[model samples]
Target: MLAVHQLYGRQSHAIDSGRAADWAATFTSDGEFRSPSYPEPSTGTAELTAFAERFHAACVESGEALHHVISTVDVAATGPDALTSTAYLQIVGTPRGESSRLLRITTIVDELVRTPGGWRIRRRVVLRDG
Candidate 1:
């Protein structure tokens, strides 16, 4: 769980720095990631990679600096190799030369599994809290 949290933090940091590949590598090969705009899940490594690239491109092109804060991470071990977790997240972004504004505050529910590469996110669902 600690490793998972670190991975999430690193991914967020990479996104903040506009590094898409580093952020995308945090997920499993068959992982599924979903966001409000996605409307459906992005499945598999290729899809996730593309999604991350596009997301980062859009944010950077819009000249926004994204900052993500994650808290209240609660992990429940479902098995020796699987776990479920939920965390509260607040994301803020500012367009270049503009003031920072809240992007979203939500709960991120994740399903993770132990892999050869350590714990990798299998699925992530983001629920808006406010």
Candidate 2:
């Protein structure tokens, strides 16, 4: 539980600060991440890190202000060193010269494992909420 919370907190902070490398480090070497906007899932830590960098670059180029909120995490231990969890996410982004726009209200389902480096996400599936 504590591990899960810490991982979530760290990832959130990384995103808030536009620390792409830090955010990507929260995933395992063979991890997978998927989002509605991504045509295909990203696999492996290297690819994931690159994906994060590209995402941050795009946001910066757009001159948008972005914020993310994560809440209501429900974790279930799958093993002594693994767990599956789901949480709600809300994000808002404002374009360079426009008012804030709600980017998404969704749910994130993740499978995580406790590694030598602490808790790391093995798989993450994001589902948008209408």
List candidate 2 stretches off by more than 4 Å.
Answer: 96-99
User: In model 1, which residue pairs have backbone atoms overlapping below 3 Å?
Assistant: none
Please give the CA lDDT of all the candidate structures: 0.83, 0.87
Q: Candidate 1 regions off by >4 Å?
A: none
**What is the per-residue lDDT of model 2 for residues 1-130, given as tens digits with 9 covering 90 to 100?**
9778778888987876778889888999899999896898989978887887887788888899677778898999999999999998888888888998788888999999989988899999999856
For candidate 1, what is the TM-score?
0.91
**Model 2 residue 123 lDDT score:** 98
**Deviation of model 2 at 39, angstroms:** 0.6
